[model samples]
Target: MASREFLKILSSARLGDVSAQQKLADAYLTGAYKTPIQPANALIWLEKSYFSITNQALEGASSGSTQISELIAQTANIPLAETFGSPAFGFGWNSFWGLAQSSIESDSRSAAQWQLVNLLINPINQDIQKQLSEWIKKNATSLEKVSDLDLGALQKLAKQFLNELSESNSSFATNAKELLIKLQPKNEALSSLWKVWQEDQNEEALTQAAELGLTAAKLILGLRLAQLDGNTETKSNASLKKAAYWLELAAKDGDRDAWYALGEIYRRPQFSGYNAAESDRCFDRAADLGHAQAQLRKGASLWRKREKTEEKIRGLQASYWVWQAHQQGIAEAKELLNKILDSCPDPKKNDWYELAQFAEQALNHHAEHKLDEDWLLLSHRIIIANQFNFSKAELLLCEVGQLQHEHCVAVDIRWELPKILPRLIQIESIQQRRALLAAGKVFAAADLEIEGNLRQRRYRFDQVTSWLVTTFFKDQTESAIN
Candidate 1:
């Protein structure tokens, strides 16, 4: 059931309040803004809200818990967390219940089972876990849903939970390994070899399998050799040489994972002669071949190497690979992309930089020509200017207006309260209320002086406002369309 507080926020958000919309989006993302975990809704609000601070550098770090701290740091001009309330607090639910319910309704037993296992690792009460254990026994026979949870978080949680069980002497300990294999399955033959090798503490079967051309098996064996070689590179160690031989064989057989593994081996100078160039090539090959992890590695690698050379678009190139990985549903990639995009400038989109500058000026209450109902009809000019062609700015602006006020929203009929009034009157604090209104003014204060037919330079009003609206979608006339 939705909480009363969530309901109130939603009501305000529906009425077109900018702060409400942003808060609502934040809530969905982190439950911090005092909202439940509903990423779909969060994305909607994020796409809809136009921020006064659009600089990527201004975004709070992706750490869910530190959002408030980060927000406080970003808005230093305002006495925050005090007379003016900081964004409402709470970490919304990012739990197993949603997936568990989906598992119950779906038909994919594999997926359901995975969800149940994931749920098992959450910080649930022991009683709940016992009940869940029974529930899994009931539903384990069948699975029918594949959750869209962030892969990185899921993997981390899985590893942590499984590691606990592996180290414990509890009743759950016996089946922990089985559960991991079930939660994230691999090639059947390779898995079987690993199962015995890991469980029995015997490597004979796994080694045989690697020799028999099982690529996954070979990768595992190579990893074992690398671990055994420890911090010293032994050119004479037959084990290390043998590991390399098998890794090369796997790579030759078109195993992308193998190439990445080889890169990892070469990356560690502690082991032996770590050739940075060779390691880079191996990683690059793996990235080109579409290994998502490898793509992230290369992205970070290139960015780190930027200081010593005049590398053109080093960050951009890195971001492109990271973005590709993010699209493939890698959560770590999303986190990295967020940081990269926030700080990296888009040379192709200088307009974005201009917009950020305008946002900064507006927030400082320094923007000019922000009022409406003018003779020049600046709002209309912004739409017709075509200077921001296909910039996708309009959609965001429309959302910004609605976000400021629950009512009086739209491109033509925006809730244009005075430079002193908030879009949402529900704001109670005088300073807080004023802060909201001021932010709105900042958004409306876009007056771009561009070269014109009548004059060398002309002020374009509502450039920021119209930019809040984006027509990136087909056949629609609402801010929500884009």
Candidate 2:
């Protein structure tokens, strides 16, 4: 059931009507109906009209179809590719220009068009390193011209070229300084552009920026490489070496961010060979440089070491470092301070609670980038405590088949028992256990040899438990949960 308005638009579009075609394109581009329409479909309709108008101009060359060509030129700036490329498939360039022209008649596509033009021109035609150096020298006085051009367009082209440059060990490093110097004045804008460029995986820009001694770029590239190291099954010494090299350079330059990054690398046991001593040193250095996060890390490391050694002097030292970090506005430090103070052997528990409340206020004062590891530790502690008290563990198991804490899922059963039997035994409620047993029976209908104790009863549960444990609980064994 097409609406009258839709039918009218479709009828006009079918009669080779440019206006009707554009209107239909607008509908698809805007997703005027509910649930936002597909951008590819929008582009198809828009491109059809665009091509038709262009072909008409080309065919009617003897009669100077200026209007048709003008229309085609106007439509060329639509970001059809950008829209179609998005996961949601929303309209981009097509809607921006069409809507703007229909309402305000403003030409928003000029910048994008200019950028496309520049890309086609390929200002630096030779090797990027050589070309960039020459361009910088030639245009040093005319640097403002680069800024004056469509920045958005130039940024897109830069990203594309930078990606190409990153693929090979080209002259990017040699000319990186010159290019950065040319762009240094526009640091804020360039940084924003860099964020967008990085999303496109423009490694060349990242490499160039790193070579130009951009600490932020160096840190970002290092993090990206570290992320890749995790995704790939094998270790990448090259990635770590590259990250370490840039971080060391940045640290030497007295960049606090670099120091923090170095601390992070050293802190990660798997990545930095579990060099806690070296990690402590890096954190100390970063903390001295007024890095709050490094201070927090240093405090946490000290606290962890104190826990391992059970030395009262080390405990006091950990508390002092944590308090110092807390004063510097580190949220994790405040949290650690609260936990330490709560466990202190003070006669007045109320006073410790009051101090913890104050620490909570301080904790809320700081911003956190990721989930704190303390939460997992605390959850594991709670779970272990519950397991020690069998009644509480049974209560928890009665409510849920598995107790899901931040650290791991606790299935109520002894560790030595075969995997499946414990899960079946954990369901304390008779009805739920019956349902689960019945469900299990569907698979075990043929083999009905229900056997001996919990260990023997786990024969069927073993297969299911093996899969579950391997899939979800494999990494969880690292946590010291009794």
Stretches of candidate 1 off by over 4 Å are 1-201, 228-238, 270-273, 290-293, 307-314, 324-339, 343-482
Residue 77's lDDT in candidate 1: 16
Candidate 2 regions exceeding 4 Å error are: 1-199, 228-238, 267-276, 304-317, 324-335, 342-482
Encode model 2's per-residue lDDT on 27-124: one tens digit a residue: 66544422145555555655566656667767763433655444545444444333433422222333332332332223333333332323333344
TM-score of 1: 0.33
lDDT of each: 0.47, 0.47
Angstrom error of the Cα, residue 274, model 2: value is: 7.0
How many backbone overlaps does candidate 1 show?
31
The root-mean-square deviation over C-alpha atoms between each candidate and the true structure, in angstroms, is 18.8, 24.1
| lDDT (tens digit, per residue) of candidate 1 on 141-213 | 3422324344344446556646555345544443453444344435677668778886884679889777666
